[model samples]
Target: MSNEQKQYLKKLKNTKIKILFWQILLIIIFIFLWELLVNIGVISSFIFSSPSRIFKTIIELINNNNFFIHIFITLKEVLIAFILGISLGFLIAIILYQFKLFARIIDPYLTMLNSLPKVALGPLIIIVCGANSKSIILMALLINLIVSIITIYNGFLTTPSYQLKLFKSLNASKLQILTHLVIPNSYQTIIASFKLCVAQTLVGVIMGEFLVSKQGIGYLIVYGKQVFNLNYVMTGIILLALISYLLYKLIVILEKKLLKHI
Candidate 1:
């Protein structure tokens, strides 16, 4: 490589480092200020729990052997919802794209469902799917599935017309063209959808938990509110944040690997 290219790369690396440094510094400063405010009686710990108290509550949860159970329940719901959402969405999108008549027919219905607020269906879903974890997964599906189908379907629609004609001229079947061109070309869109699906699934699961779950982080938040335990509420929120970040980071890693080709 040329000296100029090496120097440019080094500069970019240094810039990334500077960004990371500032992010950490800001978090530390914010935590310090928050603790200071709580310690000085500016904010009551009962209503607004400090970072230390949040950490302490987490520790207590660990000691009680309840941390992993709650985390696991939520994670299970999220993973199942994510998998089903993406797979079903992608499959349905392919079918719709191949059959333009079907696509046009259902376009309005899909649009309607996507815009509908999913929470309103919670009770009906629980009534049908039962009050157990299936309802939670279905709740997540209600959110993630529609979003995924719309995103991927639109991405599929963006395939170049010239390329489609070329494939047609060569006597390529719709499935063959889709496998060879449309789907492969839409990797960035699919990967982007993954990030959104994870978050939506999490939201759905938490909402479901709020309504039906006896255990899980969402339940903890509700229970905390009932008992006026800000520590529990704060801890539940912190854990939820951590879970979201970890899921997002995993997608980032996958994006790096897949998007490098882009």
Candidate 2:
């Protein structure tokens, strides 16, 4: 409604456009440089595959009818793990928030488990779940679940003290206070947890795939290594990077939509 506000919005839009332009330009430059260096013999194509070689590898995978299969498998695992992680984490965080004594009792153990290297549990997971997708999903679930709990639980704890006192003074029930005040106040944190969960889920899925999968990008990377085909490895990495970027962008869009009210 005001000229100043309109100009500020225009300026912000231009800044975002400039940022996108630079990001795309940087990727193009990097690819061009990589290809140029490989062509000039500055880097061994066998070890550090060229962008063109990666493209060829992707084409080869497509011709072999494995490209979509691999992508689909990995994406499915990621989606399943992400949803489970967030849901379980949210439930657990709520329980912890409601029970201060229990939260204190388990805090150290949670910290320990979080700090432990998850890959170390791979062999045990395979032993228990068998060498299948179950193991992969479990491995991914184990990795992301703890992180979601911690991030979201901490977010819940950050509810304003004054608000808590006000709710108490109003004789509100605990559930009413939580529903009306605490959870609503942590919407940003919950969305932030979603972003973290997405990335963590991807990492877990890849790790699980590496350990037990016959299909997926992680399997592709391992297979490439065994066959001494660095191009496949590079292509897998590129595909993963693209997947991660797209997933992050989706979360950002979701964040914008969800937090528009805030």
Candidate 3:
């Protein structure tokens, strides 16, 4: 590579290293403050557990093999809902793009549905799905689908007019255009939409679990609160954060791999 390219790569590496360092530093500082507050009695241990206490709870739960079970259950629900929701959303977007009149007709209603609080549907979903994994998956699917559809639709619609015209002039079929131009052009947007959908799906799953289920991380959180075990609650929060971060990292890696050629 050229000297300039080498320098640029080095700079990028340094920037990423600095970012990681600061993130770790900030976490340590926060933990220190948390411990200090508990030690000073500024925050009651019962209501606001320290980081150390949460860590202990996490360790104990892991030792009992309960943490992995809850994590796996929640992860399963999230994965199922995320895949189904995104696939359905993509199919819907393609259908809408093919029919402009339908897209125009449903635009306002889609916006309203997206704006509605998904948590409000949890009880009804539980009633219909009978308070099981299906309820959690459906809840997440409902919340994620609207956003994904809107985003992917917008991405598809925003495919450059020039490219479409070119494809038409070249006598390209609809499938050919979609494969070669539309999907590639909208790749970034679709990935971004997936990232957002992941977060919303997690929220939906947790809310569903909170309102209905007897297992999963949200159930653990509710149980902890009921028993006044703030450490357990904090442990759940930490675990959720860790899982979300890992999911985000996986998305980033996938994005890089998929977009490398583009």
In order of lDDT, best first, we have 2, 1, 3
Task: Tell me the TM-score of model 3.
Answer: 0.93
Judged by TM-score, which candidate is best?
1
Candidate 3 lDDT over residue span 73-191, tens digit each = 99999999999988999999989988999999988999999999988877788778896889988999999999999999899978988989999999999999988998889999999
Q: Per-residue lDDT of 98-213 in model 1, one digit per residue for the tens?
A: 89999999989999999999999999999999999999999999999999998998899999999999999999996799999999889989988998999999999999999998
Q: Which run of 10 residues does model 1 get worst, by summed lDDT?
A: 253-262
Clashes of each: 0, 0, 0
Candidate 2 root-mean-square deviation in Å? 1.7
Candidate 3: C-alpha RMSD to true structure equals: 1.9
lDDT of 2 by residue, 1-262 (tens): 7999999999999999999999999999999999999999999999999999998888989999999999999999999999999999999999999998999999999999999989999999999999999999999999999999999999999999999999999999999998999899998999999998999899999999999989999999999999999988999999999999999999999989988989
